[model samples]
Target: MPDTSFPGAWSVDAEGSAPPFEQLRARVLDLVTSGDLPAGFRLPPVRTLAEQLGLAANTVARAYKELEADGIVETHGRGGTLVSAQGDAARRAAQQAAAEYAAKTRSLGITEADALELARTALSLR
Candidate 1:
């Protein structure tokens, strides 16, 4: 029995703008990035978490799929899903941040070339 008691009080706001899966995904990502849910922490099975959160099993599954796709967690058949190593999580986080930045730039009408240049400048400053 993996500890289903997630570190903090995580809940999906049904009335919030974001869908339940996105909310769950973002919360888990935050926990991983903040080290609250350290590497090797096993997440509850999708059905289990969905029941606990009163969400559809598919919703939980989708969230887990996205997390796995982002390399923040690894799903091993019966072994269950566990948080990835810290270095991997950090790299994934940076990639996710870059994706979000690109989306924001696009929304702001910034060209792809400008966005890449801005990112380059930002990296050069470090």
Candidate 2:
């Protein structure tokens, strides 16, 4: 059984090129799709996350909104947010494959851009 604890270490890079909301959204998506955060994980409240990451509550809310829109998470008023189990089997398989690819690519010291280009090339080949 996975911990399913609130993943508080998810942080924002204030100086990075990506907008804070986008960064937060991506981190949440990665956590869900990586299986580090299993289905049914409860996310920290928007205000709490904002305080932890030094972002505005609205920023975190926006990220949460995006995650909900993408079906990675579902929010219940007063009950908080939870990782969705809607695509459990498919998501688990995809995450496992992604983990394998990431492990292999990291062993070769591939940068994100290189990995993305590699994926793009592979997609084109298909």
Best by TM-score: 1
- Every model's TM-score: 0.71, 0.65
lDDT of 1: 0.86
* Highest-lDDT candidate: 1
Model 2 CA lDDT for position 72: 85
lDDT of 2 by residue, 9-124 (tens): 55678888789999888788777877777777888888988887899999999999988876788899878888888625446666888899888998999997899899789756
Candidate 1 lDDT, 1-126, residue by residue in tens: 657568868788999878999989988987888878888999999988999999999999999999998889899999998897742665666888999999999999999999999999987652
Cα RMSD for predicted model 2? 8.7
At residue 9, candidate 1 shows an lDDT of 81
Report clash pairs, candidate 1: none
